[model samples]
Target: MLKNLEYLKSGNEKQRRAFKVINQLNMMEDLKIYSPILCGTIPLSIDTASSDLDIIMEVHDFSGFGDKINFLYGPFPQFKLKRKIIRSKLIVKANFIYDNFEFELFGQAQPVTQQYAYLHMVIEKYLLDTNPSWRCEIIALKERGFKTEQAFCHMLELTGDPYEALINYGLRKQII
Candidate 1:
């Protein structure tokens, strides 16, 4: 499912719509050079009405990437772009709304496989598939305003910075 967007076509209503919007915008082909992968709640079927589409990519050229995305999706409603450092690593992000689904394109110089979004999704999917009950529990936590990682951490009794803790758990369990 992570290798391509094809699975989304047969997923729930939201996933189908996500597939449409992504294709309609020619997102994959346009960003093909960067190797885009949609990673987040939608694919896991744990999303809420407010969940945004998170597309992660490996980008080496910030300037070129920013220029390309701005050219392609900049005209969309609420489109915005920014570059900032997170955990001391540079990242480029673009946000926009299309077909009522918020789209967040996150790019970092690191490999997509190494990005936190991708890693988290892999671990989250594993956990959700591990216990059917946890899916509802995690979603319930999300509805209560917990971020995905936070919800998972809370449910797992992980006690540190949720992000790092979850990743650490994944690493220890070889799940990420």
Candidate 2:
């Protein structure tokens, strides 16, 4: 059994196993996994405990297949798998055949230019300061329709400082 991030941080055996699995999974061709909570790209609230793992990948020639390919290719042979594909998103529900371990994968669409831009900005800023609070602020801004998260991420990527003016403007509005 794999431990969650909290236990992983404390160097528990389960954590080690989980990390090992993550590494192995990463090594698989055409797969990328990301967790905003785990990456500190978003606030770590209690809600993250039950969050499903999120992944993005370039499956070879998956343009038309999208979710279907994920459904067919994602599961281990022994696992009983259920899958759904909506637009570019793929959702899977499965239990490990051997251990009865339950897991899910939520696949997002291949990022568009806007999303890539947002992610780039976010990563740049995160690299500069690693401030979880700031990341949360960006997410909030995105949710509030200021811009796509990718756009914000891209802004940060380009300037390394974003939301400074916007944040101040918002603060002044609240005070007024």
Candidate 3:
């Protein structure tokens, strides 16, 4: 479910459940205008029980995107919406818990593929595929409180900021 997301239907239990929940809420179709893309730990198969479903979107109309998110998820458990500036871009984010899965809807004017979350997931997936033995070590690092990207950075011996380090490494290696 990293790119097209259809594979989620046949993936592991959590993945299948994620697909069902997304379909049940009509998330993809409803947010199709914004190019909603699933990007997060689950797709990388290293998700812990606490991992939330992260859906990134390309949104130029902040007002409309905020309204749509509010209308769609404001009633859900622990639903919250906010606008904030990240990386010098004002974006909208919504969070809610439903069916035992917490959902994070992140919208920005930039293309979803260019967003850090998506890029990180893609790079991590690539590393996982090419280095099978690192999976357990990465997960172990995460269990010790390192974030996903941080865990990857630690394995690579990247010393700078984990997020930036990951991107820089990926760009130099052409992984993303």
Candidate 4:
């Protein structure tokens, strides 16, 4: 987890702002949101200056909740935002100047639940170890056609126990 924090810190100013926005959103109690997958910046190599924030929020429900949440973010007066229902998820796209950020809220979704669980397990086991090599493995997996969330889930699936297969793969690829 420290490495992940470091990864965020290494990002440019806009990425750092995106991270702050995510933190603010997550800290909202009315949203009932959790398990934020801070995707775009950390894993996708999206430059802070050019990329939008991509975040997935796990929620218990999605009925009329997106608009309500969007309204709650009235603090950001200069931003233009839109909320739409996308399947079982509520998608929020907020833009200001040239910067865009997105939030996807998943409600009672099985895939979201599974992914969050897998992410939690993997982070708890591997990320806490502060291994730069493991971080490299994550980066490599992200580079290899896997979505940030998917790659992490795949790593969790492949290793069963954290730091074993992922670290080995990184070492073999000289990414560690």
Which predicted model would earn the best TM-score?
Answer: 1
Candidate 2 C-alpha lDDT tens digits along 1-176: 01134444445443344445544544223333322122222112211222223223322333333454345445654544455675445543333321221233333344421122234333334433545456455545555554433344454453433444333332343521
Writing each residue's lDDT as its tens digit, candidate 3 over 43-100 gives 8778887899999999999999999999999999999999999989998999999999
Between candidates 1 and 3, the TM-score winner: 1
Question: What C-alpha lDDT does candidate 2 achieve relative to the native structure?
Answer: 0.37
Model 1, position 45: C-alpha lDDT score: 94
Q: For each candidate, what is the lDDT?
A: 0.93, 0.37, 0.92, 0.47
Best-fitting candidate, scored by lDDT: 1
Mark the regions of model 2 whose C-alpha exceeds 4 Å error after superposition: 1-17, 24-27, 30-47, 63-176
Tens digits of per-residue lDDT, candidate 4, 1-176, equal: 42243455566665576556655555334544444454443343422233344444555444454465556554553555565665455555444322245443333343443443334434433442544455557556656655444565474576443335554444454544
Using lDDT as the measure, name the better of candidate 2 and candidate 3.
Answer: 3
lDDT of 4: 0.47
Please give the ranking of all candidate structures by lDDT, highest first, separated by commas: 1, 3, 4, 2
Q: Name every residue pair that clashes in candidate 3.
A: none
Indicate whether candidate 1 or candidate 2 has the larger TM-score.
1
| Runs with alpha carbons beyond 4 Å of true place in candidate 3 | none
